[model samples]
Target: MVPASSEATPRKRTTYTDEFKRTTVARLHSGEQSATDLAIELGIRRNMLYKWSDKIEKQAPDKELRAPGRPATDELSEIEKLRRELAKTQEELAILKKFDAYLTRLKK
Candidate 1:
């Protein structure tokens, strides 16, 4: 008869909390130290640090404490307003280009 041995499975990766992510991003943006060095000190990968930085920049918020679930109705309205502004700006740009073309033709 042979003795049976149990095998250990790989452990799941642990995710950093929102507060930790915010603190790390702040340290990186402080301009007082190198990101790679800070990453090593914090025992996190440089790639992860960069990913977190990108997320923070795109989100443009220090924290996402907006309660659980979908965004608030007001937040959706703000997003729609920004979209409308962008469309208006694009239209104005197109009109300016047409006016410039007309002026160039007149000059010629």
Candidate 2:
């Protein structure tokens, strides 16, 4: 029979909040220590800290709604309204052209 696995099983993944990220990065930027020291103190990976810092620097201040399972808001109503207005303008141009043709025929 095969021996039981010698390697340790993988650990479950964990998540951190935005607040935690901001606080940890702030501590790193305070100039009192390096990322390696901070990572050890915080029980997290140094690379994770670096990734968070990069994200914070490139982030913009905006609130965007994200939904993975639903369709986005519909713009079809506004598009249909503009299309109707365009058709009305085309009809008016056609009437004006017919009147011009009638006037020219009368003058011939």
Candidate 3:
């Protein structure tokens, strides 16, 4: 068997407690410092700060953490997820077709 390479192993995601996340998000919202600066100081990605804030906004007090795209449910059913994707793809296709028609008119 080939030896496992350290580089090939994925790093585990760092998990933060709700209280820590809550305080960090609150500090960000307080406007004492810019989000980029705060992220640098805290050694976290700026986008993660925004994500935590969004989650907090959607959560009821003392509620379990609710993931994005999952509200009041363990997870969205696969069919529902697929339906959403199909709808989005249909909208994109419609727009592209309209754009193509517009360009064809321009070429005439």
Candidate 4:
């Protein structure tokens, strides 16, 4: 009888890119095919595909609002106004603290 070890072929490790993983996860989410079927067709394990799908879902929120251009003029103005207000508030607080310290020194 032939040895069982000799009859078995070695399996190679494969690496997939982010684009491929995203595409595969998208297909899996479409509900067209079972994960087992897709994994088998793609020559990868079902568990690996599941992991990829989970990762994609977890990162979906972060990927949703990717603005590819400059901020709006109104947003820029609002930010600048808030920054100026914060600086003015900080300066006023500093002045008040200095006055309080001077008053305390006078009382001493």
Off by over 4 Å in 4: 1-11, 62-108
lDDT of 1 by residue, 29-108 (tens): 77577888998899888899878866765565433422234355567799999999999999999999999999999999
Residue-wise C-alpha lDDT for candidate 3, range 1-108, written one tens digit per residue: 666674477778999999999888778777788889999998989999989977886674433443334344323466688899999999999999999999999999
Task: Write one digit per residue (lDDT tens) for candidate 4, span 1-108.
Answer: 998878978777788899999888878767798889999999888999878866765556553322224344466799999999999999999999999999999999
lDDT of model 2 at residue 30? 70
Global lDDT of model 3: 0.78
Most accurate candidate by TM-score: 2
TM-score of each: 0.48, 0.50, 0.49, 0.47
- Each model's C-alpha lDDT? 0.77, 0.74, 0.78, 0.78
As a TM-score, model 3 comes out at 0.49
* All candidates in order of TM-score, best leading: 2, 3, 1, 4
Q: In candidate 2, which residue ranges exceed 4 Å CA deviation?
A: 60-108
lDDT of 2 at 74: 40
